[model samples]
Target: MNQVTRYSPLDDLFRGFFVKPMDFPSGMPAQQIKVDVKEQPDAYLVHAELPGAKKEDIHVEIEGNQVSIRSEVKQERDVKEGERLLRSERYFGQVSRAFQLPYELDEGQSSASFKDGVLELKLAKKLAQPASKRLDIA
Candidate 1:
């Protein structure tokens, strides 16, 4: 006799679930996210691809020791009782990313903007601290 373990319904619902209708402003998740980092001697420019995403729908935040990027995509969906949905495939939800840098950066100088479905981020590197001279006690 073989017995199948009962799994959580939560797992099964995901199998064929389309974008669930939600009141959330941004109805879509990170549809397609791509990040490009340009390393320079003085700074690092990070660019992210947010296709079908809007500037107002995205938010960027930085903490003392962390940098976080988040955004949402929105869409519309309709349903009719017992109606067959021909086809649909669109991801909707909040997307986030974070990264750490070796050198300190000037948070005040950070800037972000969206252009042609791409997010451009400009970060200015904090100036290196001068080495402190050590004096031996006489």
Candidate 2:
């Protein structure tokens, strides 16, 4: 059996009037953080795009081989006596992203820098040691 689907432009228009844009069904505002990772011989490079975020509002945490990046963006606008807002697309909330490295990372040796709404992380790889061998019982 073949099923047919119907499209209605008016349905979307009516839905848009009642529902707020950027609204998620989960009720929690969605904040997505984009990131890129590159691997090098000695270290790994991570670049995260965080527009409208301040450096002081960004935090980086390293736990074992996982790296977590968290940031909050706040935006406020002052309206005049006779001003009104039509549409707003700016996001203002907390966003976090975590990544796991292929190898263990040296937390003490890692460095991070943020500039122009971009966060760059230089994660140093920990040296691999030989596994311990257990002695056989006599």
lDDT of each: 0.75, 0.88
Model 2 ranges off by over 4 Å: 1-29, 130-138
lDDT over C-alpha atoms for residue 24 of model 2 = 41
Residue pairs whose backbone atoms clash in candidate 2: none
Show model 1 residue runs off by greater than 4 Å.
1-32, 77-84, 133-138
- For residues 34-76, write the lDDT of model 1, one tens digit per residue: 7888878877788998776788998877664356778887766
Please report the candidate that would top TM-score against the real structure.
2
List the RMSD of every prediction in angstroms: 11.0, 8.9
Error of 2 at 45 (Å): 0.3
Candidate 2 lDDT over residue span 1-138, tens digit each: 999999999887788675666644444457788999999998999999999999999999998789999999887876778888755656798999998888999998999999999999999999887899999999
- For each predicted model, how many residue pairs clash, with residues at least 3 apart or on different chains? 6, 0
Question: What is the Å distance of residue 99 in model 2 from its true position?
Answer: 1.6
lDDT of candidate 1? 0.75
